[model samples]
Target: MNYQAPLRDMRFVWHEMFDVTGHCQHLGLDLDRDTLDGILEEAGRFTAEVIAPLNRNSDEQGCQLLGTEVSTPDGFREAYRQYVDNGWASMTGPMAYGGQGLPQMASACVHEMLMAASLSFRIYSGLTEGAVLAVHRHGSEALRQTWLGKMVSGEWTGTMCLTEPQAGTDLALLRTRAQPQADGSYLITGNKIFISGGEQDLTDNTIHLVLARLPDAPAGVKGISLFLVPKILTDGRRNELSCGALEHKMGIKGASTCVMNFDGAQGWLVGEPNQGLSCMFTMMNDARFQVGLQGLGIAEAAFQGGLAYARERLQSRSLTGAVAPDKVADPIIVHPDVRRMLLTQKSLTEGCRMLGAYTARQLDLEHGAPDPEDRRAAMRRAALLIPIVKGFFTDVGQEVASLGVQLYGGHGYIREWGMEQLMRDSRITQLYEGTNGIQALDLVRRKLMGDGGAELHALVEELSQHVEAAGHQPRLQEMAGAVSQRLEEWRALGKTIIEACQRDPQEIGAVSVDFLAYSAYVLLAGLWLQAAVRAGETLTDGTGESAFYQAKLQTADFYWRRVLPRASAHREALLGGANCLMAMPASDFSC
Candidate 1:
């Protein structure tokens, strides 16, 4: 099945639900509705025509390593060139650096479409943006002048080098060493593993943001510092870094995941000394949200493919009656189980799209708002939501993709169908950018308890206000009420968990996953309610296409009735406490 960008839904969320034009005005940007619409349309055309067709072929061919150079599959390089030529790589970068300076919302929509087209292909540009943001926020003037413009223009690419052979999640265990040279630069010597786009031939140079230790520094994570290590030097000599090997993986075969060996590589420090993790968080936070978008994109593609197959694939007659009487058998869509699967995918995908867009708008407000109070509030909300977006979206993404495969039955098992490929590609999103488990812990421990639940309480109040404003409308009254009720329950659950954590610290770890999932369901309910209200208003006015508005209402109802109940299961799990989970000892299983 062909991939199509969900432009109508995206436009509705941007214009109707979020008031993105108002955001543009707040930021002093000259982005009108027409321009935004045109951008979305052109982006849709580019991804569908140029990028989507390369997905399967790139996966089949993968990447080849010849000595120190890594070559992408056929069409990959040209497609990237087209992407850069179209200025997509710099869509949301700083305008002073040859970028379009668009808001995160616009960039978010474009990214969703591109990721749906090919996650492997999108990785190259996404990493570059992350690196650009880091330098823009923390790099020295000389560093910015030397590298930021080229990176923003896609003349070069970037990578985040954090992992080592001994340290995967624990940065305190890192062994990479950075020795100071006579000049301002340092000699970075260590082996970094699992670096995405680490050795690709997509750009003239690859700038690595690495974390390493100084000789006289303190022990553990405190001693680590950030550095800029280029693949090639400014003096026209190759750096000491090389691709030691490429890891063979189950998914995203087209994306090169490399083991990089930096042997006395020339580097420059970023930010203050012994504060590398803090600087890295600037990029990591952005990356977490983007990974969440990746999940939404994959889920959307899977849903479209499954829905199309269900409408076309003939099966046994409907239980009630034959919907397609002229055919040999009724379409599988007539079956209740198939409808359940399709609706589940639809509910999750649409809800995720709205949530992702909302989060993107929050990011814009956090960065662009003139008032200090507004920026702080936006920052808190963004922090509270990022983990949920990352953890729940990816978990549900895997579920949706698996259902897509199930919808195809035997055909999904074969490589020709493409469903399995999506599933494989989506699985890694949950593992990388901090594992979903780590995200859950961060949500409950760092964001929630770290701030004494103030951010979460603020979010609950905001959702309550939205529900109250829309409560009078007939079509939205039920959803509004449901959301309000869920918000109260979420607050109560938060209080209970906080009280439990005060008694036993392990309680936080035991229930974090369930708490994160529960939070996501409630949050998505509010977003869906917002979408339903806007869609209902359009229908009441009798403007635009009726079918599109109707689908919005139906999907919202499906989410409220079918998907929202999952929150109860998560609530029960969260309240189950830590005893059962900690009951088993370390060495008792084998016997």
Candidate 2:
């Protein structure tokens, strides 16, 4: 099934659940409820109509590369043109640089739609936002003057060039070099692999943010520096960089993942020397979170497709009895097992949307909160949530996609129905934007234990208040109780691990993924309780949206009673310690 944007669900998360307009107002933005609603509505319409139609075709044709030039799949170029023409690229950018300067949450809402519609097409415009933000936050005035406007307007797309022939995640092994020259520009020579959108036909030029080292710099990651290398110079002369090859991958085939070779390319520096990792991180963080949005979008699309198929496909009668006696057999949706798969997809999809939107609100707070301390607190909160958003959301997204395939049986295994494409596309999100394992390590070792668990403590404190209050309410008591227990379990488990890590350095690594998963369940359960409460409010207040609110409450009930139990298993695994894993001798293991 072709994708359809879940507008009502999105509105529930953005407006009803969080009151995002109020959040925007507090961020000091002029965006009101009407304007935000219109923006989301338009974004929904655009993606459903223009972008979704091209997804299957794009995957089949993939990207084209000839003589160092890469062209997108057939309809992608036109769709991208419409995307830029609609001012989508600059909606979330800084107004001082020719953008609308809307709240980040507004952009998150739109981005979720774009990502859901066509992730492959979205790849072309996606990196531009992060690149624009990195330059705005850290680049010099002249650099900003030259690049910001065009990029914000979607005239030039961007790429992050950190991967090389030898270096993957280990930047210390990077060998790309930049030679300083008299004109104040450096000559960059290097080859980067797995560079998405390294070269594309959609934009006028491609701006690459490359990581390289100068002659006098130090060793390892400390010596690395960030550079801006454009494909075409201001006067329209082509630079020395070219797309050496395009990777033929399993999925997201529509995106041009390339091997780019830079031969003494014209370049300028971004941020200080020997601080490239730090600077690129600004771009990376934006990318990481957006990748999580990618996961959310893909999951939503997969669920929609799967749910639709389940309702129509007839099979054996229900175990209890035939729901459709007139037919030879009932729809597969009548089966309890089928209901299980669909509910799993639904609960996870809805929970992740809340998770994505919740994190976006913190980001809005980080950028716009009036008080300095409030902004810092929001930053810490966002930092803690980022890894969960990146890691856990993508993990569940893949699970949902796989279930979508399962729902269709043999039909899902093939390319025709498009379910397999969803599965293939969803696979990449967990691997890229720093693998989910890396995300877990960052969550546990860095965000959780790094600050002595301060960030997570703040998160627990905030979520606790709502959960504890809900426990006293009549209808919310059971859901609240389940979530409240998990919240404490998470806090205690974290405390135990932090104390153990002081004695054993590798202690954190052993259970980091498990801990991250555990934390994610707790966080999701907390958000479900919040949503359930709001749905109860709507029902009590008689909004006349009883069916919608009831469905939401039922999903929340499923999450708490069913999904949240996964946290207990993770906690047990976390407490199992590092010994069993570490005891295996390196030399003894053989396949």
Candidate 3:
């Protein structure tokens, strides 16, 4: 299947929906539309022409580990060289670090394209960028001077080494230890599993941001300290870290997920001692948002493949009549069921793009806004939406990929069609970057109930204002009202969940996933409404392509009618509470 970057919709979201250039202007960054367009076009070309073709081949060959060296798939090394030489990796990095310092909005678009082209290949640089962000934010001036420039130039890749074999999500159980030395550096000794790009050979050196406890540190998560462990030492001797083994994963085979053993590796602490979790979170949050974009990218690839197949693959005649009378039978696109599946993919993918772009813009505002109040507001908004973006986008990504498979009937199951690869690749998104369950719990326990729902309430009010402001346009007035009503419903549901959680803390976990999904659907509805309003205005003024705007309106309508109703079921489940779920005994399934 051929992959085309959704540049038009991305531009629509950036310029029309989010006004990213205006946001950049507020940051005193001279990022005009033309510059962003050029970046997108060039990135699109690279992904489509250079990176995308290697996706399947790379997956087929996978990564190979012989001795201490791990080799990426055939084309991956060359592709990484091209990616670095083009200055793509440094787009969002600091200007002082040899980066172009573009807004995250542009990086988000490029990231989506790269992920769509080859998620397995993209994982390398994706993790590197996250590591760079962390070290830049939390590392000392000397550390930054040593690592930031090399990483920003893509000369050295980085990894986040947090998950120990015994720890997983429970960071409290981590037993990794860092022993201090007289020279101020420490020796990091730990085994980190599921470490992406841990031991890849694409770069001369791999910088690992490890989490370990000091000898005199307290127990549990509080004792964890962040360390920078490099594979190669400053004097050019190899460090003690090695890839014990590569995980035989179900997907993303080309990306090396290694079990790393840091046997007293020379390292320097990042941030303060025993503050590793908070320090690592800076990287994890960036990674989580990028993972959400990965979800969006994979979903888009599946949607395009499915749509193309639906258009060309002739099947039974349409219920109404033979729409393609000249052919042997009507194309499956004529079938209502096929159309339903396709529309679901379309609405979810496009809506996710808008949400991701908006969130990326929020990230830009959080970091670059001159006003402290603006920064705080953006941070709160980002915190509120990051979990949803990571969890819901990944869940919907799997859903859309499944729909793509179903649309292909028997063909999708085969390897040649490439739909199954998308499904397999997207399946991991929900698991990593703090699993969707963790995200849901964070949403309900931390973001919502933790703050008395102030951030959420403020967001609802802001969205309400947007809806009311669009009341003048007849086409958008109804959508605005519909979305406004859903927002109130969402707000009420949050209160109900909070009240229930007060009665029984278990209620938080019980309703958390449902609440997250419901919130995500409503949030997407609001974004889709915003996009629909813009599309409608364009169509009304006869200034843009009629077909594009009409398609946007139709997808928005489908989302309201079809996708939005799923939130109602989620609400019902949320109200059901923990009784039914908890009533069953743990041992009952053993029989």
What TM-score fits each model? Answer: 0.99, 0.99, 0.99
- For model 3, how does the per-residue alpha-carbon lDDT over 1-591 read when each residue is reduced to its tens digit? 888898888888888888877888998998788987888889888999999999999889999999978999998989999999999878778899898888787789899999999999999999999999999999999999988998988999999998987889999999888999999999998799999999998999999999999999999989999999989988999999999999998999999999999998999999999999999999999999999999999999999999999999998999988888898999899998999999999999999998898898889889889999999999999999999999999998899999999999999999999999999999999999899999999999999998888889988987787787668778777778889999999888888888889899999899999999999999989888878888888888999999999999999989998999999999998888799999989999686
- Pick out the ten consecutive residues of candidate 2 with the lowest summed lDDT: 464-473
Task: List candidate 2 stretches off by more than 4 Å.
Answer: none
Question: Which digits, one per residue and each the tens of the lDDT, describe model 1 over residues 1-591?
Answer: 699999988898888888888889997889999999999999999999999999998889998889988998889899999999998998988998898899898789999999999999999889889999998899999999998998999989999999998999999999999999889899999999999999998888999999999988899889999999999889879999999899999999999999999999999999988899999999999999999999998999999999999999999999998888899999999899999999999989988988998899889889998898899889988998899999988998899999999999999878898999999999999999999999999999999899888888888988888798678688788888888999999988898888898899999899999999999999989888878877888788999799998988898898989999999999998889999888889787777
Q: After aligning candidate 3 to the native by TM-score, how far in Å is the CA of 242 from where it should be?
A: 0.4
Report every candidate's CA lDDT: 0.91, 0.89, 0.91
Winner by lDDT between candidate 2 and candidate 1 = 1
Find the 10 residues in a row with the least total lDDT in model 3: 469-478
Separately for all candidates shown, the number of backbone clashes (residues 3 or more apart, or on different chains) is: 0, 0, 0
Q: Stretches of candidate 1 above 4 Å error?
A: none
**Over the stretch 72-133, how does candidate 2's per-residue lDDT look in tens digits?**
99998888888888999888888998899887777886888888888898887888888898
